[model samples]
Target: MRVSVVINPKAGSVNPGLIEEKIRSALFRCDLVFSKAKTLEEMDQFLCEELAHKTDFFLICGGDGTVNTCLQYLVRAEEDLTKIPPIAVVRSGTANDLAHEIGISRRIDQAVRNILEGSVRNIDIIQISSGDKKAFMLTNGGLGIPAMTADLANQVRFSLQKVANCPQTAGFFKSIAKNSYQLIKKIGPGVYSLMVAEALRTWDPNGWELEFELPGDKKFATNAPIVLVNNQPSIGNKFLPAPFTSNTDGTVNLLLAEGRRVREHLSSFLHLRNGTVSQSDRFTSYEITEFKVRSKNPSRPITFFGDGEILFKDVAELSVKCLHKGLPVVVGSPAWEK
Candidate 1:
């Protein structure tokens, strides 16, 4: 079998040496090519070369951002879904939401083993658009709090890199941040919790007056401080905004919550951390094929993010739809319950 591994060297705490060592131990008698993608141009070049080679499978070693980067290329590369090789994700990034949802192991050897001996599953991809700009979301998308926290987290990461001039020191700081994120995730808060707290200091209740167009042309307009569109279960790492979400179900999961008041938002946060947010009265949930959201007050534009990366900013309206069984992916033994 031929395999091409696309690696994001700056992802999470794992280094390339460890990943290569594990792959060598686990995979034998197979043609392998490894490519390091530290920038968009490099990743695109690698993909173009490997696609010509007709790689049988792509093993992506990074977080959700890296996976999304690869997916963007693939979505535009092929018109026929069957022509694309199945993708296998390895957990080697800060927020491995895709890996966790599909039951990919964090251990390098086990992850490679799963890629070699795993079942292929079809998963949905979210097609997001605003005006003429279009993109694909592999896991989740959100406005309000999710968008706010993603921006803040990115600023913090950038600040750290700027201050730490030495690459070694920057990597060390990244490891510390990643470890801190994981520790918080286990305690049920997730990394978003800390950033959310900081966000509340500048919180504006009137900022998110928006209108939602659900399936069947049903319109619901309200003031919601958080809105999430999910193709998978959790956001960040463990904050289960849509606990029963299914990526292959031909529909996307949506959640809207009013996190304006301190006490009300606090309760909502607790429910999110516990995976009970869907059942809470303060939140509204739906299963739909497509939806449109726009800022009711046109003066206050909205920004949305997907897979922990910002998609569009200062937009009056955005639309998202589910592309059922859009991508073929390899899953581990303990793959998500479908």
Candidate 2:
């Protein structure tokens, strides 16, 4: 098998040289022509041209952004889309949400072993569209409240010396609370209210606004405040937003936070970090193949964040859909195999 390894050197302090060594060690024992994509642009071109003409296995190593970026290229390049190579992940990123759900380890030998011993599983991909000619993977998407929080989290870090001794996510949360006063002063009370989607009204008991249309059944709108689209079952490795979802589902789970209180957000935030938010009252789940999202205004400021970074925004319309069992992924289980 010919394997292409796409790696990002900076997915939370990954040692690029060590990764190369690990993968090379594996290939030494196989009849594989090894290729590597060092940057996003190269990964994109490789997926589009190199991948389109050949049939082989490919590997991705890095954070969520790195994985999403590579998927975007493949999704765009292949029109038939059904026939493509299965990808193996190295879990070289901060969250490695995709890797965790699939049980890929970061320790080089273990991850390589998993890939070598694994079977191919078909996985789903999200297509986030804008006014431009291209679209990217929408593995996760959120706006309004948590969206603002993600942005604020980065700012808080940069403002305070742009560095930290031990900047764990918990510390980031503390910074959020400490700067909550400042955020309210600057972003206003609407900031938190946005999490509840102030404009949306949920059933007093059921929690979510349940008004969004489920694919093919536009007869009525369901109510849900925050409609989160999930590709994999977990994020940050453990949060099972939709534990039942697998790569072959041909659909992504849509989760909605149905409550109308910011105070509720406090607990939910922890759920998001700890990987259990899917069952909380502030959240609900659904499955969809395609959907559309509209902003309050056409010319307002907005940002769609995925896996802790902003991808794109500043538009009023969004066309989102799952490519439907588009890509094959590498998966292996070790501890239980014994």
Each model's C-alpha lDDT? 0.80, 0.60
Expressed as tens digits, the lDDT of each residue in 193-305 for candidate 1 is 66778765666786569999887879988888878889988886658888788999999998888757867776877788789885788899999999999888877788888
Tens-digit per-residue lDDT, 1-338, candidate 2: 66767767645455777888888887676544434565666667666665755747777777666777777677666677676688888876544666766767667667766666877777677777767734655356565454555455445434532233336546876566546534433442233334333322321323222234457656334333345667766544434566676656777776766545555654665576567775576776667787666654444434566655656656565666777767778776656221
In terms of lDDT, the best-performing candidate is 1
Error of 2 at 281 (Å): 4.8
In candidate 2, stretches whose alpha carbon ends up further than 4 angstroms from where it belongs are 30-39, 46-49, 52-55, 132-134, 152-211, 216-225, 259-261, 270-282, 299-302, 307-309, 334-338
C-alpha displacement of 237 in model 2, angstroms? 3.1
Highest TM-score, which number?
Answer: 1
- Output the lDDT of residue 284, model 2: 66
Model 2 / residue 229 / CA error / Å? 1.1
Which residue ranges in model 1 land beyond 4 Å of their true spot?
166-190, 334-338
Worst 10 residues of 2 by lDDT: 201-210
